[model samples]
Target chain A: MDEPEVEAMDEPEVEAMDEPEVEAPGAPGAPGAPGRGVRERRLHPVTPLRRAWAPVAVGAGWAVHDPDGAYRQVTDLALWTLLLAGGGLVVAAALYGFLSWWFTHFAVTDTELRIRTGLLFRRTAHIRLDRLQAVDVNQPLLARVAGVAKLKMDVIGTDSKDELAYLSEKDAAALRAELLARAAGFAPETAQDVGEAPVANLVHVPPRQLAVSLLLTGSTWVLLVAALAVPPVLWLTTHSPGLVIGTGLPLLGAAGASSVGKFVKEYDWRVGESPDGLRLDHGLLDKEHETVPPGRVQTVRIVEPLLWRRRGWVRVELDVAGSSNSVLVPVAPRELAVEVIARILPGVTVPEAEALSRPPERSKWCVPVWWRGHGLAVTDAVFATRHGLLGRTLALVPHAKVQSVRLTQGPWERRNGVADVHVETGANTTVAARLRDAAEAELLLQAQADRSRTGRRTARPDRWMAQ
Target chain B: MTQQPGDRYGTEGSAAAADAPPGETASPEPVWRSLPRSMLTLRRLLLVVWMVPLAVAAGLLLGLLAGPAWAAFAALPLALLLWGWPLLGRNWRSWRYAERADDLLIQRGVLWREETIVPYGRMQLVEVESGPLQRKFGLASLQLHTAAAATDATIPGLDPREAERLRDRLTELGEARSAGL
Candidate 1:
């Protein structure tokens, strides 16, 4: 572990030394060394692919103007006529791409990250440095080939609001690190030169596992099977194979397409650790790069499908502040998932599997199916609720993240002397410990209420800049 | 909104409100205050004066267009209005709010009861608003906004002066005890 940590720290510094940086005077990091205006400096130029593809797209559009065959028209066209029209269209598109690339620029001020873009309707958006949440660097398949990346910055109270696209990969990585460090309140001079550090890889999924997981992770294949079955069933009754094939084949194709899409979106999934934050990269065509700070994660869930239960494989999902819900570890052995959880949440102790037994025997009447699986474990820092027999799910929510706790008893539950306790964390996640003894529910509610009080008292303030 | 910034309703007001039946503990719990009585009368008038007449006119128009039998539709609104008159009073009676040391408590509902406790420290903003009907009745509402999007706890049917005072008190306490996540 120490070796990995050291290697991770060295990776970025080594990479930064290789890249040549255009030093702008009076940059945000180099405070007081001011004479020149850093704000006027533009970002790295966008890749020429934008200009290269514009003409090809326009020409393709012209060629495919008619859905039916228009090859006769193409062949009959004069060579000079084709050159004049195609050349004009290509030049026009290339000019537009060039102008767009030239006009867009971003600047870093002490207080804010200013982005100026748009051609006709010029827009200048500034995000306060104090409110900066995370800086993501993404490289699509096309941009990867061109060695360019896009940087997306999320602010505390805003959504995906600002981005600098088509930057050299080195610049993108440097900017991402600098912004993140600045957000964390590290001084400008020391933190600014974080360009070269490479993230240390913690988990890498092999191709076989990725494929198997993709196939079993979602229920899209069920749709494919259902669609295929529909045609055969219809054939027995209507005997109109034509109509059945027409509708079912399209449905089958759509299901297949969606499954393939999910595979593409999650291809080459990787998780790594950097000095600034945890880095996650995925997607084959349109990539997504996300940085989750140490304290930004609110809740984590460990899910084990029925098929995976026998193998002791669990999926670790996390909720971060600025990005969508993501799986930190798609499918890992239970011990590995727990180890990763311990790493992510340092103080929270997850008990061994043997200790996480079923709820009290008195509440057996409330739970009929696989009653042995229901359980709840509470620690000073976190609480875990385990339920679901077929597809078991163990949800862990830090005490500080819990907004409220509810204890509910329906008519049947009241009769059986059982109640359910639900803990909510903002909008994204909730953990419910179901079918517990009514007395236990009351105790749990009170304990959780106390936990929330202590958690709030000790928790870090939401705005670090305010401190 | 003109607000008098002070603890104007001192111990005397809380003591008076705390005069509840024995067996319930005091001191730890703040005395709950009910909405102004005028609010109930205003609601009854709005239903009887505005809603019922509109329904009756619609019923009459339907009768003219369709048949005399359709005019009987007017009775449905009349019956509903009569049934809802006491419900409105009961709802007003059920609405109560208490200003606690650490949090504000709101309790409402006749059947499915709900009690919400909004921590003063968690408050992001405090707003006082009134519509035409509420203004006509000299009543306003105090809304407490927090980071949680679902928390819409607004204490309605307060006197405009009282509403402003409560808003100021909440704002002061919110700033003084600022613990946020």
Candidate 2:
């Protein structure tokens, strides 16, 4: 009912200041407070330059391509011509970017955050403060160099595409704190204290160790073997070094590029704890600062690759309700990973290997290789499952967060009297126990349903701060 | 496995049954409701509407270009229609839903059997939709949405009145047992 009125308002830019008080009665925060409503603000002026870089680079690359002589050195005239063309392209792209930046405006009211964009077909998106899930501050390499950051907000029941690009880093952080405070039901004046909340660093991943772990990954090994075997085989069969160069170079380049991407993406991963929630700061090229509100985590997964296991390392990933950056700790010692898990889901123990219920021996026909590794455990607080062959993954989902439960049986599984039980959550990480006795699977389903019912009854309230 | 209008499960009395104490002994045999058999007719009608024209066009094109022997390939759609006729009925029979005290159970799939248990507390929204064709046939489909996308439960081909009643009942239950994600 309130949404329609908001959407029907034609002149949001001129009338938004006074519209919220009458239209949205139940919206969070004090309505009609003097000087409390934030005025419409434009992004940093440098936003156009930062946004235009990608197009400028592409245009430069296109201008440099010569069809006449593929490997010919560029003449002085051609070089001058390329520079002039690139300059013209940059100016055109920057003008377009500036127009877009001028049209986009965002403002914060007592009740909601409103973002208006589009030059020809204007659109307005309203995010209720009460439904704000999390806030992320991202800085792309160019934006970082330009000293600006982008703010992304995750709202409940909506895909998170609401981004305020190219805000001053200080402004973005302050705005993030203000939004978090309002979402937590704090008054405007008291919201200032939220920004100063002390943070306790929990985990810091070393760059060298991260690089080593990436090298030890299965893909890297496959790429290495292919690189070693393909050149020799190509030489012997085709007798043309040119053919080897044609095919082998691109393959090696691609592998190298992906490995380099990962290395840059996860260069300096760090996690910290604050009174509000867990804080995650990561990336080398495009630095990202994400906050996972307490009780927002749906599932926790600990992965141990075959090679990582020998070094007693594991990767901890959390399926936070709204944010997409799920890596809690990319690579850490087993004990440190457990400690991080404990910090996230307090008082819940990770299921020990001994406590897991292994599938019946007769069900081994379903998965001969990984049957022994497959196990399921239903604890009072969480449902845990262990599976995977080359890399062992132990997934733990809090019973309170279980959205639904499912049991599936294929034709082959039916013949083997085995079934798979999936504990579904709102996040992508689903905890599943594969190849279990059909009878046990049925019982587990019922038991899980009952446990989830009780868990929901005793679980923390949605508004953690209010509690 | 066609359920007649009279055989439809009465929703009027289920409110009291559902409100009973959770501690009560579980129902020994929960009532399972099946989709109306008209769904089969609707599906078959759609299949014919889409395939007949394509089949005729294929037969004409092949007869002109590659000789009449190639026109035999046009029978593929007809053959598929005939194959799917009984398979759709069997799949329809396999579709059943049961409303338990605390949760709803939807069991489906003929080859890969899947049983989804969605707790009433977890239901975020309940929708009743009727397309133009379905409206012409006096039928509607009820969809149950939870936080998880994987909990895709849709009961298609229900009497319009029954679909509305079920949607109202489920919405009430969901509100009463609402839980945070």
Candidate 3:
């Protein structure tokens, strides 16, 4: 196709598979690619003007906190302060220019999406239009108002490297459209992270579900339990029933505050699929909205903090192509989570595993295991028996990516001959556990790595191109 | 576990390039070959970050001697140096891409030695990043995306023009290779 010729002239992106190279699909994108568009002009981008204020605000905040002795001397006190203020402004302006310059020029030709950034260290990268796996569009309140969006690209042959960062919403949409046109097999080995979008269901967790989402995770539970006990404790301290009762009322107030905080954090949580792949957006503090295509997923991890086990809730995530590259959905019903994951990786099996019984509600430490642990222990590590919060996690490292096996000995653990053996299962970022029997753990890590590799081997389709 | 007949996912050469005339390398370009290195610019820029704190402290101390009036002002070059050092260092440190027959070789890192090998057959896409400094240098860094690590396997430095050229070469190679497969 004509587009393939263009893709031929674009930069190659995706994973390193030892397959015979073939004519990759055209850049128009396969049917299910994300947003699609093409740049038609050589124009300077229109950058949002408000970004200059952020650093200024930050500078002001720091100045407030630093009144103590941060700026005592005046090589030119007023000038330096002004410079700090001005520095923020200059950075803001420069960045706006940078962003605008970037937004305007960043284009996806017939073959690749291009970016030219920086004045000194000029750099450019092209994602083969055909290899585009998923396009994730994120819009913050300000970005939305500004009519700009952040696009995260996931593609075949590419690991979880952060995709091009910012773009105008219109451009992002077009880019997605263009990408969707070419989202076919660019990599022979990995499964494309494509999913049937979840049917919109009205029965989603309501305001109450938001409360429930947080009831276990947020600090509200501890606050509630604390509130109930405070009355008697206050009474004992005051030797006055009335004073204790008054104190008890305040405890209840604290509980309400805690509940509100949690609700806000889980506000508008969603787990769904866009044409490209899984899209998830949640959290209040450092908000995160991300997407992952099936093919890019390297491994899967299912986590159930000990307390959550009672409700059969689990967290899901995939190490897409490397460490630091991941797609996570914070909570899912155990069964639904399994089903969702199974669809992405038909070969992977959840295997009827049961949660650990009577796990401590709050332990000092929570350890993540190499295998889904199946309620097994690798090593016992503690800053002391009294340290660490209690939690449980299950990590899945796809067999295709196994790096190294190691057992660790920390300064604290040295006194104990026990070592934390780590089974690193993935190409870039590997999951590790502290196995007490260092030698045994090493053997196990190697063995498990081998087993995972074997598992991956079994998942490959011999008739890969038939479809 | 009973292995199904088609369950064998992939063979040994799953993501690496398997077919190529043994040792052919990509042709080199003359226009955008080497990185621009000017020590004076490097020193002036890096001196900002390196010297900022000291300048600020000195500004404070000077305020004590010459008074706060001169303290903060004295630290300007210092601040710029302190902030600019690593920037220049990183720019200086990065290696550009050289298209190879079987793989893309990316050499980059400030202190740590990192060389990423991206086999063409395994390549997903190529990306070019141009930060603030890049524009000034008229340089661009071509990233060779491989399935290895999202951010790990990348070749960072190149002339913007050369980067575009190389991107084209790899994409064509990838297309040709992919089609053959």
Q: Give one clash count per candidate, in the order shown.
A: 7, 0, 136
Candidate 3 overall Cα lDDT vs. reference? 0.49
Model 1: what TM-score? 0.76
Cα RMSD for candidates in order? 9.5, 8.1, 17.0
lDDT of each: 0.68, 0.77, 0.49
Per residue, candidate 3 scores C-alpha lDDT tens digits across A1-467 of 23455445444534333335321222222222222333322221434354455666776788688765556643337787878867777876778666644333354444456543444444545665444444566666666666666666654444433454456766665655444434433332232222233433211234554566567764677778878987878777778988877777777888886677545555666666543455556555434455554444555677666667788887666665322335354566788777766656555555444322122222113333322232322111100001112455555544434332333454334443334433333245445444244344434433442333234333432122224
Candidate 1 chain A worst ten-residue window by lDDT: A10-19
TM-score of every model versus the real structure? 0.76, 0.81, 0.47
- Considering lDDT, where higher is better, how would the candidates rank from best to worst? 2, 1, 3
**Residue-wise lDDT of candidate 1 within B35-151, one digit each (tens)?**
999888888998899767867797889899999888888888888898999999888988898876656767776643445556666677888999998999999988887655556
Candidate 1 ranges beyond 4 A from true positions: A1-41, A47-89, A156-161, A195-200, A231-250, A284-287, A351-377, A386-389, A403-427, A430-450, A460-467, B1-26, B38-51, B54-73
Order candidates by DockQ, high to low: 2, 1, 3
lDDT of 2 by residue, A1-467 (tens): 12233234322322234433242322223232224335666788887875587786774575567534533433535877868876888888888789878777777654577776666666678887655666789998978887889998876544544789889988898888877775665654566457844689999999999999898788776876787679889999989989888878877876776577778888899989986678888999899998776778899999999999899999998887667677889899999988888988976888777888788887778888679899877666788899887789999999888998888999899998999999889775567888878877877776676666657766655445653
A1-467: candidate 1 lDDT, tens digit per residue: 11232234322311122224544544443333324344433555654446668678765797688634557776778999978877887788778777766666676654457776666766767776554546678888888887888888865455544677778887787887777765665545565764544678877655566667657754677778878788888888899979898879888887876677766766777778765567787887888788876656768889888777767778889876455536787777788778778777767767555556466665666666667788877766777888777787888888766655555666567677777777766534667787777776766664564455446666643333223
Estimate, for each residue in B1-181, the C-alpha lDDT of model 3 and write its tens digit. Answer: 2333232212322222233243352232212233445433534544655576677677777888886667767657665666666666675646444455544544444433333344454455778888777567565666655444433444444567777887898887765544110
Candidate 2: deviation at residue A313, Å?
1.0
Assess chain B of each prediction and give its TM-score: 0.81, 0.83, 0.56
